[model samples]
Target: MLRLISSIIFRLLFYRFPQLAYSQEEIEEYEKMYSKALTSKSEIKYSSNFPKLHFIQYIASTKKVVLHGSNHKGINEFEPRRQTLFNGKYEEAVFATRDGIWPIFYAVFDRNKLVGNFRNACISSDLKYNYYFFSLTRETILSNPWTSGMLYFLPEETFEKVNHSLVPFDEWISKSPVAPLTKIEVEPEDFYFINKVSYHNPKESVIVSWFLYKLRTKFFIKR
Candidate 1:
């Protein structure tokens, strides 16, 4: 009886708040504009010659698309799934990011290896650039069996902004399945800090002493 009452209440609210809903024609118009913005001359001319920080800033400013990265390839569509995020909360959604560099780490990572990893992205004090830090265990860094992955470009229409106070990256989540408009294959070498990655022990906290990090990197990391 309670479930039925709740359903009726929700239906009444939805109908009463009609302005909160988007019409199918409005949604289609938004998608068309997003697609056009993505293919604009400025977006087409973006190249590696520009600093990665600049690229991220430009994408965030445009808000035309969100990015998702994964080690698995040949993915035509992304379905909403339950995932545990850094905050220890489980959510059912398709996660994406406005920050361009954050997805690159996910693309190159191999979860099957089951090793420790730490990654974070932060904006500079002036808010003009983004800084990234990542570390992996000695064995994982040395073995490095995985070489490539895929970065997916998803339309921004259906995604909602995630308000995460603990994380610095601009994250978005969509409950509906998303089909990628395009995807790019990326290698470890393509990551900006691939050579500068530090070493850490899984048992310990993410923080590593400067001296210990240097010692481990010198002996174990292969660059």
Candidate 2:
């Protein structure tokens, strides 16, 4: 009975989030990069290229690129870390991507640190593609106002490059660790949100899902 249930769950997951098949060569490369990054003892510092910035959220499905409270606006409130940034200190950044939902990826950081350089590499949950290595300094954060939270959507074309450059932020932070490493576990609900945001075929499915409609209307729909 347990085996049967396990099989059913596996099938359901596969159906909902199809596994991406990567070549053996690609898999080997990611493993190599991940191993090297994990074992490296080199000092990782934040790059000077990143500007001092902070963001509340991002909306890519619109015309005007709106950055809600970005560009070092909240740095004052983000004290201690804020001082570090001003002192030219760099925060370590780690990257990861989910399977089934290919494009929605994440770059977790050691508390208070933003993305460092753009040459580091990290591993992926799927082990299919790696994470992108990009600096998330004030300039990049202000320039690229993306939807907030752990969830992010990037173009399909850039997926490969992003994955190859995945650097483990936690690994770097471990050198002179200040905070605990964050392990982000993507939930099923997150997958649903990514799908709704990234691939919305209004003809095939309703743009405003039932849950969203309820949330939007708040039980005040008139007959």
Which prediction has the highest TM-score against the true structure? 1
lDDT of each: 0.59, 0.25
What TM-score would each prediction reach against the true structure?
0.64, 0.24
Task: Give per-residue CA lDDT, model 1, range 1-223, as digits (tens).
Answer: 6544543433322111011234465445544544564565112222344343334334445557888889987887899999865556788999987666668778877766646555443222113444445567777767774567887778899999765453334567899999876666676766655665666777775444223544554566464
TM-score (C-alpha, index-matched) for candidate 2: 0.24
The candidate maximizing lDDT is: 1
**Taking the tens digit of each residue's C-alpha lDDT, what string does model 2 give over 54-103?**
01011112112111111221121111121121123553422122222322
Question: How many clashes would you count in candidate 1?
Answer: 0
Question: Model 1 Cα displacement at 140 (Å)?
Answer: 0.9
> Model 2, residue 38: displacement in angstroms?
0.4
Candidate 1: pairs in clash: none
